[model samples]
Target: MSAAAEDEREEQYAFPMPPAGGWTADDLDRIPGLPPHTELIDGGLFFMSPQTDFHMATLRLLEFALVSAAPEDLYVVREMTTKLAKRDRPEPDLMVVPRKARTSREQTWYDPSDIILAVEIISDDSVERDREIKPRKYAGARIPHFWRVEKSNGLPVVYVYELDPATHTYAITGIHHDRLKLAVPFPLDIDLTEI
Candidate 1:
């Protein structure tokens, strides 16, 4: 195709412009042609890049482990946004929420209070957000528990953090490289090598 023709075609498929105050959390559901796992943070929309094999394998391993270990009252979910504020709705790679918090099958997001644990598996494109930004936001929202998984030597390294309610910050609890054995957020004994 000619350069001019391609430019015109691209303009026709351009994403919607943000409203006066940028995009709201609710706007995520209404936006058309948005790629899957789109998030709203501080009134701005963030689109996720395609997943890698490392990201996918780690996510699947954690999700399966969490689901198997979670109590009957807690539910495991993947790629579901958590509503932290009007403009801050982030989709953790995997989340453990209260079974009762699920309002309906159509529910797109969960309240932060309903989430017991939020896990983010680091991806090349999301290193900064997973390592810093999202953890700060989740801690501020007092989500209780957060786990960040990083790929090292072709293996998953899990960094666990517990929210400090008084300071609204996260305190590092443990960093598990091989076996993930945790007492809080339910008893979890996962073999990271499986990923």
Candidate 2:
């Protein structure tokens, strides 16, 4: 293109693309709190899609199961923004921090190393992000286990991710059916029907 054409084209798109920058932990502090189940993405804050009755029920049931299987000492945080780095603190649906780390009073943020497992419940708003995006970030941090729940197909599917001893990245171990009859993550062995 000619110089004049190039200049005109550049002028036509003078405005910058939005959500343009990475978000830092300090930026997380600056943003106002949103209502429950909401999250920050890119550099903007937005609510996680309104949850369905089944979704809420599922989460509640899972919480109860975890509480029963695991002792009270393991601090479980719901919807907490774990400070992983200057730019990322994933609020996994459920995370269990070691009892000692949880008791530590010198911390300004939750350390990634303290987290044993990270769980995410996927809705329409988070399917792609939970499945495709979070693994890369979480695996990079060497989180031992990750779980994903989705109801998109009208079936309560579960995906379990674990780190292979030989590889740091996560690989799927098993996929569970929607039925409330199976249990794999030990101690969490209560039947789905029981929940």
Best by the TM-score measure: 1
The lDDT per prediction is 0.91, 0.67
Which residue runs does candidate 2 get wrong by more than 4 Å?
1-22, 33-38, 41-46, 103-109, 152-155, 178-186, 193-195
Q: Write the per-residue lDDT of candidate 2 for residues 1-195, one digit (tens) a residue.
A: 999999999987463333446556555544444355444444544467677876786677677767677766687666776666656666788877777876445443467787778888887777777888777777877778788887644545667888765777899887766443224334465344432
Name the TM-score of candidate 2.
Answer: 0.74
Q: Pick out the ten consecutive residues of candidate 1 with the lowest summed lDDT.
A: 38-47
RMSD in Å for model 1? 1.3
Model 1 agreement with the true structure over 1-195: per-residue lDDT tens digits: 999999999998799988887888888889888989988878888889888998999988998998899999989999999988888999999999889999998999999988889999988888888899999999988899999999899999999999987898999999999899999988879999997
Error of 1 at 90 (Å): 0.8
lDDT of 2 at 80: 73
Q: Please report how far candidate 1 places residue 112 from its true position, in Å.
A: 0.4
Candidate 1 wrong stretches, greater than 4 Å? none
Colliding residue pairs in candidate 2: none
